[model samples]
Target: MTQAQTGLPDVNAVGLGAPFGWLAGGWRDFTKAVGPCLIYGALLVAASLGLTAALYHAGAIRVLFVVAAGFMLVAPILAMGLYQTGRMLERGERPRVGDILFVKSAIRQDLFILGFALFLVYSVWVEMAHLVYGLSTHKFHKTLPEFVHFMLADPEGHNMVMTGTIIGGIIAFLAFSLVVVSAPMLLNTKSNVFVATLTSLRTVATNFLPMLLWGIMIVALTVLGIVTGFVGLIVTFPVIGLASWRAYRDLVPSSEGDVAAAAG
Candidate 1:
């Protein structure tokens, strides 16, 4: 049966260690275009730092977890430039500052649609965070430390924690499934939002184990970036971005004609 008929997109079977290879390839790409890649990384870090500061100023530090999770919700759109860089590398060209900054080819109607859909998902999560917090805890803490104590020690807070974690986990997985491959597909190909999204879901279904490992790696590095006060993101952000591109490259097959054209 053909892939199209079976409704399973053509995807490579990735090994358990495949994500690490992608990371290594990503590191190489980062070094190959160190200046531009670092600048891209810095931009991501700056944004993260800005959000953190805003949260602190708003005295909503307790919601920082929601914010961080929301950051991941939109991260694929943020990494379009990095995907372009990977494309350039694959085409036997050095990544340029302009390519890393403005991916002209990736700017299309479908990309916008994908972005808007992700934004909607993020908005829903934000609203759900409010509901979850309300249903989870009896009182909101005024200080960050107090919130931490409530989350860790209070009996009512424990219930909130359980409920929030369960609901948030599902939301996170849904976001991951929706964007993991579709975002890169939109950036790299002529696929529409619906096709890209369906393909992404199929890829996940067909390769659940490796994809789970990949998702875990992404979350771990992101948490590390947050724990380091967003400093580690200077490296982690671009690394993950580039590595995601590699993942897309590995999973999706190229058209033979396109491959031949590139070779020519």
Candidate 2:
């Protein structure tokens, strides 16, 4: 049976399995791959900071709520460019920094799907956070220091935080389940979106443990990026992007035969 029959995508088709030497290679490659993404990320940070500064200067911190709404409205569309850039790098091609400007043709439908999924995930996360806090309200009230301080100090509150975190994590996992393989699959093939999403969900369900570990590593690295004020994202984003392509290569079955059939 061909690799496609075995349900594995081509590892070498994208040149994604380069040895560690070529995978990250040096700071130069990292800079090349990540520079464009960093600039985009920086733009996002600047917009957010500008809004925050304007609100603070005006003594209207409450305006941050509207600013946050604007952020959510725009972030998913920007995320499409980020993922597409990663795909280009995975294929061992140099994407121009301005290539993201052609966002009109790239993954528009998938971005909408991803955004809706994220909304559901965030809603669930918020609900869980509120539930945990509500449960601990009495304890927080009776404790020394204020509610926020008490939550930070108590073991039970810590457990609540852990519970809320896990709940949010599960939602995120579910949201990604519908898209992880589908994103690349859609990029590579002319398959229908529903079929692509179904295939992706099946791929994740069948390959649960490794994908779960991959998800965990992504979260950890993202947190590290945030903690480091996004400077680390300059390296982490491209590395992880390349790594994701490799992971998808390892996970998804080859489609050579299908491609040949379609060409004919």
Candidate 3:
């Protein structure tokens, strides 16, 4: 039966090591347009740092955990420029600063819809974090180091971290499954948000291991970037974005017939 007959989208499965290959591909793309890519990454990092400082200024350092997780939720929208860079590089065309920055092609209704969905998901994440902290009100972290020690060294705080991690992981994965392919796909195709998100979910289910590895790699690299005072994001952010574009391109087939070819 054809992919349409079987009621499946045109997607492919890959080995677990495929994500690493995608990362390598991203690095190549980055080198081809380092200046533009790095500039794009810097803009993102600046926003992140600004928001973080705002939170600190507001005496809400305790909710930094939620903010961090929320980044994973909304990051796809932030990486649109990087996706454009990848697209240009794939065409053997040099990416210009204005091309990636303005990204005139990305100004579409479907992309806005996708961004809205991510925003909703992020809102839910924030509410959940508030609930978690509200459950245990005995301790309040007024600073970063205090929050770290509370989460790492205290028993109740450890439990709270575990709970938040488990819950946040589930929500984060849902966001990832929805956006992994759909975000970049919507940028490149005329697909509606519903079809694009469905394809993203199906792609994740079909390539669980590789996608899992990919998710781990994303978190690891992002944490690495964050640890370096958000400096490393100048490189890691675009690499992950470029690699994610590669991942989406690899998982989604261009032709309906390719599904059968992949199944074979």
Candidate 4:
């Protein structure tokens, strides 16, 4: 059987690599990984709900803002565990569900790096949105107050929001190009963060179109999960995690271990 058929890495695998055939093997891995994902998701939901409830009982509309902020803080950390669990499963190893809580060892560093990178991207996106809004407001300075009132009352406000969202999204896409593959690569390897980040940026630049498609798919699936109130996340998270491992295995150039094993 060919290496690809056997789920082995191929030397010829390049940018955009093949769809991981191991995705067919995912059902079994899903069974093994689902428990932890569900547990984690449940904990997140409970914490979020509890916090939101507390704020609401205190008569705070700001509770929604707090919940949103908390989610932004926790999502990346939870994602690290999700991704790590998939990696363990891919290696046919058992992974503890609780390992999600601890961030020691190489995994911790990698998670921090990823979290920091994500925070950077989020900060930039937020700043860009503010900048755009500021610019628009400035340009219409004399009418700004009236315009704001009109926007608040008009159905066209939805369109305005959508346009702003699309612009923010483009900015985020540009930022992720520097870190997407690198985050997982850093998690899986002992490589330095700078190297990992650069490698990821290089991969995206070289495979821009396919990577963009992959990004869109990820965003769509994630939004679908949100629409389902996170129940869909149990499945979507693991699938994406496995897909990421496969993508990383495909795109990042092989290391010494890979070469040695290939020679052996």
Q: Show where candidate 4 strays beyond 4 Å.
A: 1-28, 47-77, 106-114, 130-156, 257-264
Q: What is the lDDT of candidate 1?
A: 0.82
How high is the lDDT of residue 206 in model 4?
70
Superposition TM-score, candidate 2 onto the true structure: 0.68
CA lDDT of each prediction against the hidden true structure: 0.82, 0.55, 0.84, 0.57
Which ranges in model 1 have alpha carbons more than 4 Å from their true place?
3-9, 257-264
| Ten residues in sequence with the least summed lDDT for candidate 1 | 255-264
Candidate 1, residues 93-173: lDDT per residue as tens digits?
A: 988788779877577989898889888888888888889788776786888889888888988788878888788777887
Candidate 2 yields a Cα-based lDDT of 0.55
RMSD of each: 2.3, 6.4, 4.0, 7.4
Error of model 1, residue 63, in angstroms: 3.5
TM per candidate? 0.91, 0.68, 0.92, 0.68
Q: Per-residue lDDT tens digits of candidate 4, residues 134-178? A: 544433323434555645765554554566668766765765676
Q: Quote model 4's TM-score.
A: 0.68
- Per lDDT, the best of the predicted structures is 3
Error of 4 at 134 (Å): 6.4
Clashes (backbone N, CA, C under 3 Å), per candidate, total 1, 7, 0, 0
User: Candidate 3 residues 1-264, lDDT tens each?
Assistant: 456785545789899999999999999889989999888989888988998898888988876667876787888888988888887777678889998899765798889989998888888889988888778557677888888888788887878888888888889999999999998877655467888899899999989888988998998998899888888999999999999988887998766443332222
